[model samples]
Target: MLPLALLAGVATQLRAEEPRPAATTDFAGLILHLSEDPGKFHSDNFVSNEPGYPSAIEGLRALGIHGGAYIGVGPEQNFSYLAALQPERAFVVDIRRENTVQHLMYKALFAAARNRLEFLELLLSRPPPNAPEGESSRAAMSVQELLTAVDSRGASMKACEQTIDSVSARIEENFGFPLTDKDRVTLRHIHSAFAEAGLSIHYSSPKAVKQEPTLRELMLARDTYGNHVHFLASEKDFQFVKQLHARDRIVPVTGDFAGRQALRKAGEFVRDRGEVVSAFYLSNVEQYLRGAQYAAFVENVRRLPLNDRSVLIRCAFEKPTQRLPGDHSEQADGQFWPHALLLQRAQRFVELYDEGAFLTHEDLARQDYLDWTSGR
Candidate 1:
């Protein structure tokens, strides 16, 4: 076992070995992949230790992501720890880490910009016709309206642009790091892919998970912009939770009083929004069902409509809280898979859904045309 000081020393030594990491791209285009998982763990955790830590890079290389970035929460996860390990093979980015206060401000600002855009769209579609004579209008009211409208257009455009620019500038001003264009493009690509795949993923913080309606409408709109879009819920919110008996078929008790409720809410939310919603339990459902319940849970999941295109599952093991080890939701730690592993999973999602392939409007409009129609 490494002493705390020794581990800290090793971390320092790694930076000294390579002051600057290598770049993964060679001009073809960014081999885009994203991972929302945090990398914190015990000193001995597989992902933190050597050998296991490198598997993520291996996975991305396997997926042909030679030059791309891995997105994480903070500098600790973004800097040397992960990127240094793969040195130059990948770029690491730490997106916004603000809590709800600052997040709401950004959201309000984005809404204002989006509203301004809509107003412009409407104005362009139908320019006001010339004012009728004797309408108490100036002789050049129409022309003036056009010029005033032009000036208004410029002001509103600047206002909308400034909202994003100022917010981004303020963030960089305070944090000393600006949001990179690559980061913005990565998010747009993900959201576009998800939308094309027919999955509606919301971009919001844990505190604002209830904004599903807003997220859905945003996705529906032509322009959806953001750097970080997360699908998470506040465990404290009753509106986000549903009560379930331990005996419920979809939820297997894992020793926590809240386990049944969490599982129940996830299952019910997925089912209730059927057809209109694309929901997936990305956590390791297999590991969450332990001992006597694991077999039953696995068996039931196979029978469920899990393989449907609208659903996705990415399983990873985690540490269970109780002395009794095995599959248990409470034990789940997200860091079991590094950024590379998460990126591979995202690629698998694209392949699994056959996204980005040509599909006509008629084909898409066919309600039953799912990827698994061939029975894979």
Candidate 2:
């Protein structure tokens, strides 16, 4: 019963002295280690920032992925999902070394950018908008508005190339991540791809594949309930991812989702920190995995610290009429669509492994994960 002001001051001091949660791993050191010792797997070049399946957002939200830790295979879509989940930490795992380099490029940009508008400006190497004089004012612009401004003042080829090189140099010199000549070339190519295409870059563009949705379309995509689900759809979501990147919480590792090294190490890090993996986003990687690879992936997942609430969000391409053993026949839609489904990791591992059902994508897809929440 001393003075009330004295008691308040003591309380503030105690709160200030409280211990914070230690980082599970040194982010930069871990990236350097993983890049130096990559897992034994190969993935083809996927330079575009566009996601293969934009509909995964529906499944992710349906599963109630709130955030602890997120591990995913792919490019920019992982960032989009991360924005939605607001995970405490994130790891982008891919088999391709170039993918890791691409992520590092993104990290450098994120670190360099002051806000979402500035991020897009730096990404495409376009000059910032003239109207917005300060960071606060520039950040007030919507994602779409920012894109429009950049699109209006397109970068020339020489300018774009120079910008790419400057950013690459910043990553190597300032960030302290050494880049090989080959890595620099690949990084330049990636940055050029974005600059050339602007917001309309797609997975199939310039490569001249069939019709594909642009990155802008994917970012503007809505969930099953017709809500805008893309990360850049809201200012809060964009800031959420940007803040995480600024904190060095979003780590990019060069490891296959089904590989031995990356996932195992990620699991160990999460376990060491006494944290649970909230969700793992498998974006149609199972379609390409062989039987043994699938098994190894499942085992790797099993090693992660997970609770009953942990979920696996999977993307698959299948016709509505295609049926597997024990798969229920629903109304024929007569079209192939990318379907996103969720499964409890512990439960699915036991069921699929025991039944020897990991042989094919169809085998995994046929299972009745309908009991679990899913959107599309």
Candidate 3:
């Protein structure tokens, strides 16, 4: 269980010393400027529901896809991708203002912690048992070992309250993003959920039928090749994300994919900076768009500048009688997700729309998943 401490970019070139993202002088103002007004309804998933998210990383690397800009939705799962892709900057757009506020909570956590163990410490509100101080030593530890070393005691009301205060202060004083009373309440509610559940927390949905993996399972999860690739899995991955957050390279925006302003404005910013999106993780939000909304989303995606190597990382679940076309076990299904971890050319996506291939959401979902070997 959690100790109750609760939580919590660059799109750049492929090189290790790649240039960082253009300066973000105003984080909150930029969020407002880039955001569309919140829709009437939105998914309230604070944590990622997708356990198979990392499977795409293996394919991403194998295809020589790395760095540029990453666009995604939902929660901490984006951290895992940021660790892998190391984009110059990222725009994590969701339809709800709560999502942006949630990202701010995460940003504060990232700013507070320095290493993987420290990150886990803040995340679970558990102090490190005997964490190593050396970067190399922490890098040598696996996620399982690192998490095992975290304090197992449940959270104290005092500690939980302190974290809430500290996180709010950090966002205001350090990051310059003030939290409204309502936002603070939402942040507290989200953090309280984390404290009550700790590492055992899993995505909850009224519509969920099967058990989703816990936070611990997701952290310990590996890519298709049996390599643990989640952000907290390695100290290096953790720091990559941490440093990026410190620089304000990752941003959150509110927008319905079908709505105007959000994606187009975000794309405009990236384009103005001469950056192109390399990968986009849509989860299963596409399943929610219908008719005109779906068409508007396709049009919005078309506005983003993309490169040949750019790809879309999406999910589709298996059916009782008809499984998605892949031998991989990285599949999830219920209502939202329709298939497993899927990778397809980003250019191909817009091309398909131009070719009049996606008359419906099913047509978009029915498009072929990229074969792994052909790119290599």
Off-target runs (Cα >4 Å) in candidate 3 are 1-25, 40-43, 130-136, 318-339, 374-376
Which is the winner by lDDT between candidate 1 and candidate 2? 2
Per-residue CA lDDT of candidate 3, range 45-163, in tens?
Answer: 75776676766777787778787888888789999989889888999987666678789888988888767777666766777557767877877887777877774466666767888
Evaluate candidate 2 by giving its C-alpha RMSD to the native, one decimal: 13.6
Best first by TM-score, ranked: 3, 2, 1
Q: Rate residue 225 of model 3 by lDDT.
A: 64
RMSD of each: 22.4, 13.6, 8.3
Q: Give each model a TM-score.
A: 0.21, 0.78, 0.86
lDDT of 2 by residue, 1-376 (tens): 0011111111112111233232234565677555323332222233323233334555555557687899886677778779877789998876555677788788877777667776777777677445467777666766567657677776667767776777787766665566666667878878888887877665542343344456666665555355665666666777788788778788888666555578888888888898888888775566655566667777788788888777776654465454322122221123122343434455565566767765566656656553423132
Extract clashing residue pairs from model 1.
Answer: 22-88, 24-67, 25-67, 203-229, 287-327, 287-328, 288-328, 288-329, 319-331, 320-331
- TM-score for candidate 1, residues paired by index: 0.21
Kindly list the per-residue Cα lDDT of model 1 for residues 51-112, writing each as its tens digit. Answer: 12122223233333321212221111122222222212122111121211122222223232
Provide backbone clash counts, one per model. 10, 0, 17
- Looking at model 2, residue 274 earns an lDDT score of 84
